[model samples]
Target: MKHALIFRVVLGLILSSCLSSCGMAFRSEWKKAPVTSGVEGKWQGTWLSDENGHHGELRCVVAAPISRKLAVQKFFYHATWKTILSGSYEAMHTVQKQKDGTYTFKGEHKMPDWAGGLYHYEGTIKGDEFKANYKCAMDHGTYVMKRVR
Candidate 1:
């Protein structure tokens, strides 16, 4: 049992280190991303849980779709809660451009079961405003952000 705990601790540290590194790289990319009509840029805002009233600061760096056929854009997000607990993760959303110069997207990201298992996101971007609703097995929330210019 003791050995298992030690192994888990070490694994957690390694994962945290990897995530931190990825966050830094995403931030660098965000700095160079150009502001466009599409949702490819840096965003800053807050996430609020409708289930518990918990809220926190949220930031995202959106990358352009790798393939036009797939329409999947990568979003790297760093979120903070309770003023201290923070982590970063990546999600891939299938974005569809609308006729009215807006975009809609939905995606799911799998996390460890203890964390939430799988998080589902549905959102839209309109004129520099990003709004999303997220739901997981443990919680549900809304994210509101504006393009960082």
Candidate 2:
């Protein structure tokens, strides 16, 4: 009788544990993904340093259109800074598309004998404006670029 009682208790505990753990699994409502934004154009904006709020004008042209395949996109990014530094660099990076229609990428910038460092960028497009957050080795900043042809 004692053995049967212990077995019942153990089974009850096991069932309760299983039921409790089932709730821990991820569960979310299914929703349609947003349309991908275009990143092909000439963009001009300002890079505001997060360290000291010092800003610089930045112009970039995404020479190629973002790839729309299932895999991450590889795009050509060329940019020039006017204030904090005066130079231009070209880089090709793979950017991922988010469900919210934004893009995120990480790459290194090397401008010959000029500045070089690692950077992570996240940007969103709305109408003709492109806003992005840049975090580099020395400083982090937000840039707002307007589509110019």
In candidate 1, what are the lDDT values of residues 33-94, reduced to their tens digit? 77765799889999998976878999998988978899999988887766755667899999
Show where candidate 2 strays beyond 4 Å.
1-37, 66-85, 96-116
TM-score of 2: 0.53
TM-score of each: 0.83, 0.53
lDDT of residue 1 for candidate 2: 56
In candidate 1, stretches whose alpha carbon ends up further than 4 angstroms from where it belongs are 1-20
- Candidate 1: clashing pairs of residues: none
lDDT digits (tens) for residues 14-109 of candidate 2: 454355432222111001112233655556676676755656666665544355563333333332333322333345555555787665554444
In candidate 1 the C-alpha lDDT for residue 32 amounts to 84
Residue 142, model 1: Cα distance from true site in angstroms: 0.6
